[model samples]
Target: MIRRIAATLSALALTLCLGVALWLNDWIDETEIPPLVLETGVEVLDRDGALLRAYTVENGRWRLPVSYDAVDPSFIEMLVAYEDRRFWSHPGIDLRAFARAVWQRLTSGRIVSGGSTLTMQVARLLEDSGTGAWGGKIRQIRLALALERQMTKEEILTLYFHLAPYGGNIEGIRAASLTWFGVEPRRLTAAQSALLVAIPQAPNSRRPDRFAEAAEIARNRVLSRAVTFTDLTEQDVDWARNEPIPTERRDFPALAAHLSDRALADRPTQATHFLTIDVVLQARMEHLARRATTGLGPQISAAIMVMDHQTGEILASVGSPDYTDHPRTGFVDMTQAVRSPGSTLKPLIYGLAFDAGLIHPQTLVADRPISIAGYAPQNFDEVFRGEVTAAEALQASLNIPAVNLLSALGPHRMLSAMGRADMEVSLPMDEAPGLAIALGGLGTRMDDLMRLYGGLARGGIAPPMHWRAGEAPGDGQRILSPVAAWYVADILGDVTPPPNAPRIGLAFKTGTSYGHRDAWAFGFDGRHVVGIWMGRADGASVPGAFGADLSAPLLFEAFSRIGDRPTLRPGPPPGALTLLNADLPDPLRRFDPQGGSNGPPQPSITFPPEGAVLAYQPDLPVIARVAEGTPPFTWLWNGAPIAIGDRDREVILGDIGLGFGELTVIDATGQAGTRQIEIAD
Candidate 1:
């Protein structure tokens, strides 16, 4: 009877203990685990994953996310050694450490160490629970066990690396490293690693920026302990102790400021953004822009853009000289602003003419003073070259030959070509397309011109430029035939560089807008295209600021900084003809509006005699008589075509404006004559 009672009591006790243990397990399982998702700031990185800029998180904290792989091995080893020596072997709690802490407290009447494992610390950090209370400690132990079950050791350590505070409003190893050391934590010195390990214990009191001495003391303690626990030797620790701790926080990288702002504004919820810009190139370009604009004027500003024409990737873009300078209105992005293109559009005009088979490079064209419709355009020096080859006229940027070519090609056709190339040009509202468009009487942005030039560089196919990484390139539009494109590049490649500038073998053009409001230089090599602009931000004229003087030198300097010799120019295309004036076809030898016909005598404008001054009247019609050779004629007022296919010898010139005007008549046989007259009020 005694043996039976004993067995039954033992069985009851065992069942009760089993029930209690099951209840404890259930209670632990029901513990509320806070969300493990961490909120971090947005980071803008270059193509190579270099940080270009960073934005603060909510509550104005400089907390960037870090991973186990991004940290240095030394830092991890020291951190594990100093915080939880047996972190790899412990399940959640270290009973040996706990027992030692209790024994020390009983002997000394004071608590020596907390004996909390790294997992327990992570649990407390995750919940933001205080360590002074028994309830919080017990809760941490439970949560630590749960965390160890759910996450790997590396993951828990990464959480600690991210959540551990360094100083005021700064969290994570990345933030601390960038703030104090001005570099990533991927590679750190022994001192830097030790300092990072010491900061979490007393973040506020031992901040190196505020209390360097205190921080050094804490750091030395870790290093001394590291001698035993880590691979660091006494010599390494001694060397690290001699190194100076950073006393002030560093500013995060602010390269590509405008682009960063744009990226952030574009996707506010994104944690990180990757762009195609090269940080090194971007920095160099920004420096170049600042140097170019300094001492010009307080209001003067500059912009630059560099791209790979083949792939249409923007490698570097400097929007303004200084983004913080309010006097220059640096907040504006000039690359996207619509301004006059001036002679920058000349190459395109010449290219189109070549494509239309209207003129060869060696074709003779007249650049004498002439008027079209009512507009009289002149060369930059107000001089005239009576006759010049098409190549010479373009090389000198003479206005008359370009206008003549545009007159033949029609302005609307050129615009259509641009549209086909995916370039948008803005003309004045309610104005008909006219010959003045040939000499930059329209508005276009720098980016659009880069695309156009990039097309020229890529054998006439213009690829759309992009900034975002991994963006698929679109099928480019054909702006010119391969032959015509080659011709343009060949001519531009020989353009003379500015004084004192190296001959970098670049095919480039420079343009100064009317009134010197905007100066532009667009250039390309075998693989790249770069555009530069300099002027006042407010659109005010910069006196004597010519593109050749202001922007051309900067363009060359930019190429030099790009640090690659210009690639070799491509060979001529199959259909491209290389001919001299004497060896050319009759029609291709001279630019003739009458199809190279020589049958009729040259026409003359007889009614408006040379240097004749006529009275100006609003609605008066002046009769123009042509004396000589052909039955049908084309007459131009100013440089604009007024009448075509006129069978009569006399045509009425109606509403001639009050000014010096030119009357030109082209006969059916490709012979022409002109008369300069004045209509005075």
Candidate 2:
């Protein structure tokens, strides 16, 4: 009777256990598990994927997402060994570890060790549940099982890496590494790895920056257990124990502050932004800008930009000397600020003249004081460099010569060229373009000037610059002919460097705006171009502060920091001519604004009226006639000179091509007339 009763009770107990198991499975299935998608802060990276800046996430938390692969191998080993030795083999909960914990707790009458695997910790973090109660533990077990069913081991670990708390408002290994040690988590010393492993266990109490003693104790405990649990030697543990813990948190990287802010503002929903900036170079240049601006004045600020002319990539852009200087209005990005460009535009003016066959580099130009239409431009020093070569005039930055050249080239034409080069020029509110623009009458940004100079360096093709990595640059526009660009480069290369600056073969120019309000320096080699600006942010004059004295030295120092020798200037192009004033052709030898006609009628094309179309005849030649100006005249088909020093008022165009063309007549004086016509076959 007793054996039969025991058998019945055993059968009943088995049926009850089976029923409980089925109910538990149903309960686990019904439990809600949140999605594993973690939200992280926005990060700004440089060209090499180095962090330039980072913004806090919602609730102002510094939680940067890190993958399992980004974590150091040693750190992972230490973490797995210390947290869950059976992490890989266990389903979700380790029954052996649980039994050991229960036995120890029962014997000691208190908690000895908690049997929570890395997955259980990740589950707790995801649900923000606590482990102080049996209910929370059961919830974590269910969630852990569910998570394991859905995610791989690597994915679970990556989740832990992204969600693990380290200290106040800082989560994830990446945030911890950067905060405590100022580096990424890809490479960490044993001590740093141990410390990082320990912090997440009791993040608030073991914060290295707050509770150093607790942090050290926890870190050393992990190191002590590492001997048996990991491959660490006693010697390694000793060394790791002896290493000092960080006492304070470090501020995140804040290089390229203005640009980073702009990027974030431009794309608010983006989680990461990659720029074309080189962080190392950007850091060096920012420091240089700050150092250069020191002691200049309380309100003076500086801006700089460096670009690869060939690729039109902006390597570095320093918006201001200091981003926090309230007195200097440092928040303003001067690179984008519209300011007078001073005499920097002179090079372009001279280049246009060269392309027009008006003057060579060695051609003599008069720089005496002259007034035209009541607009008179004076040199910076109010001194004239009379009868100087065009090259000399440009090198010395004489205002009279540049104004004279611009007058001949026409301010409208100069503006058109700038437009073609993709530069945005701001003429003072609703004012017409004038000769004064040649001498800083117009306002332009530093970046636009960089494009202009970079174009000159790139053989006259101005490529649109881009700041974002992987962005395709726009098509380049022809600003000057290759020969004209070469001539300008050759002339600027001969400019004397500032004191103690070695000639690094850089072609550079300096300009001081009227009233000394702005100082500008722009330079280029065969490969790179850099531009600098220094002045009070409020546009107030700094008396006696000139570009030559202030900005040029900084420009040269920037090149030195770049650690690249200036590339050799290219050879002259096909039509380029290197000659002295005496050797140049008569009309090209001296710039005569009057065209040497002495008050005669302005030259005009009579036969080919403006916008006229003529039929093409194979055997018949087109007849071209010029109105009165001078007996000897130069006729041009399109821009190239076709008939030079012709004594007659009419010239035969036997060799002219049948197509749309421009007819131009130039008198002995600098006066010219042009007609656009097309010949059809």
Candidate 3:
């Protein structure tokens, strides 16, 4: 009878064992291992991956993504030593520590150490819990074993490093390091490492930002015990023990806050978005801009944009001086905001004129008061520099000269040229391109202005600016010939720098919009192009916000910070002449307001006068006649010289095409006139 009972018990035990094995297999298959979705805060890094700015997660936590390799070795060692000494070899649980704890609890009739391994803690965090309840503990033990099978020890450690909370809605060593000590975890000191290791045990009660005494005690515990696992000497532990806990949390780096916010909004799903910004340069310029806006009138703000001249990549883009200052409307991004460009467009006008061989830098031009069809322009100082070289007129920013040059290089054509180079020149509502655009009569963003100046730095090729990695740097469009571009750069480089500032190789220009609503300073050198704007966001005029006074100094100061002194003095381009006034031809000495040369008014097409497009007719003559100026003229069809057949007063073309064409008439005195016409075949 005893034998029969034993056989029955053995059969029952075998059946129970089979059932438990089957249940374990089913649980393993049904359990969906979480993806370890570490939703860290959005981070904007510089070109070299330096942190520029970080935005808090939706839970208001400053959790930054970190890897095992990114942390200090001593911190990891201390963490393992304090939390789970057998983390490297153990599959999930330390049986020896668990047995010791169980024995101590049974003997004392009270709870002792919990004996939780790092992997088990990671499993609990993954399931979003930290309760030490028996049921939760059992579930975490199973999950920890499962996690060990799936992920290596290093990966589980990485999970622990990132998901482990330090204190007060801040997670990960990176965030805690930045918050408590104002440094990166990669450069953590011995004391800083010990503090970080102790925080995760009781993050809230021992938060360094709040409970200083509790934090110091926790830090000392870790330091005293760290020598067992880490390579820290007793001297190191003693030194770290004396280190004071941080009393207050330090603010995270907010170098490019506005840009980082925009990047976050633009790339919503991304946890990390790296920009092309140089964080060091960006911080310096932002500080400078912030300081400059301090003494200015109320509601005033400043913005700056720095670009790589060669690649057209944005190195720094400060949208506003203080992003959180509500009085200044600092939330508004002024770098991409449309505002009047003022006299900054003047240099492009002269550059275009030079490219067309219509004017030289040394060519004489009148800055005297002039009017055309009831529109007259004056100099900025209201005192014209009469009979000055083209370069001098530009340096003085004479409005009359710019208008005259724009008139010669038709406004519509000038706008078209800029458009071809990927620049957007915003015009007034429903208005055609006019000479007033030479002044601040139109709107343009600071970014577009920087790109245009960057083009000048790149020999008149305007390429699109890059702000993100992996973007292709496309070939730019030619806006001006090399000679013309060099000429403009040379003239701008001659401007006097501010007091005590060395002349960097930069060629800069300043512009103040109408009503003083916008102040701009755009500069470029062999390497960088920086543009700045200072004004109120509401378009309200500031009384003393002149571009030269307010923005120019900031521009030069930025150049000084970059340590770019005028090293490469760009020489004159081929086919460009640097002739003196006396060496210039008589006609080029002083511009004739009446015509291209020192002659009478330019001859006009009498029959098909201005704005005339004649239709092609086989029975009628395509007649052309000069209205005024010296006779004995030479006619040109399209752009080539054509025979006049001994006819000085008028000429007749036999045939014409079905498209648009230009007619040119040049007289013996070197004065010329052009008229556009369309002929329907």
Best-performing candidate as measured by lDDT:
2
Q: Give per-residue CA lDDT, model 2, range 302-360, as digits (tens).
A: 99999988788889999998888999999998998999999899999998887766777
What lDDT does model 1 reach? 0.86
List the pairs of residues colliding in candidate 1.
371-638, 371-639, 372-638, 372-639, 372-640, 373-637, 373-640
Model 3: worst 10 consecutive residues (lDDT sum)? 638-647
Model 3, TM vs. native: 0.86
Better of 1 and 3 by lDDT: 1
Question: CA lDDT, every prediction?
Answer: 0.86, 0.87, 0.80
Off by over 4 Å in 2: 1-18, 564-566, 595-598, 604-631, 634-643, 648-665, 673-681
Tens digit of lDDT per residue, candidate 1, span 1-681? Answer: 999999999999999999999987886788788888888889999989999888888899998978899999999999989988989999888888878977998899998986889999999999999987889989998998888878899999899888998999989899999999999999999999999999999899999999999999999999999999999999999999999989999998877778788888888788889998899999999999999998887999999999988789888888899878899999888887889999998898888777655667888999887776777898999999788898888888889999988887779878977786777799999999899988899998898999899989998888768888888468787787677788889898888989998887799999999999999999999888999999987899999998989999999999888866556778887657788988754445678643423446667677878899998777778888989857677666543446767889999877756776557676655556667688899
TM-score of 1: 0.83
Ranking by TM-score: 2, 3, 1
Q: What is the lDDT of residue 195 in candidate 2?
A: 97
Instruction: Write one digit per residue (lDDT tens) for candidate 3, span 189-267.
Output: 7899888988888899999768988889988888888877778999988888887889898888888888888888898
Which segments of candidate 3 are over 4 A away from where they belong?
1-29, 564-566, 596-681
Sliding window of 10 residues with minimal summed lDDT for model 1: 593-602
Would you estimate the TM-scores of all the predictions?
A: 0.83, 0.92, 0.86
Instruction: Assess candidate 3 and give its lDDT.
Output: 0.80
Candidate 1 residue-wise lDDT at 376: 84
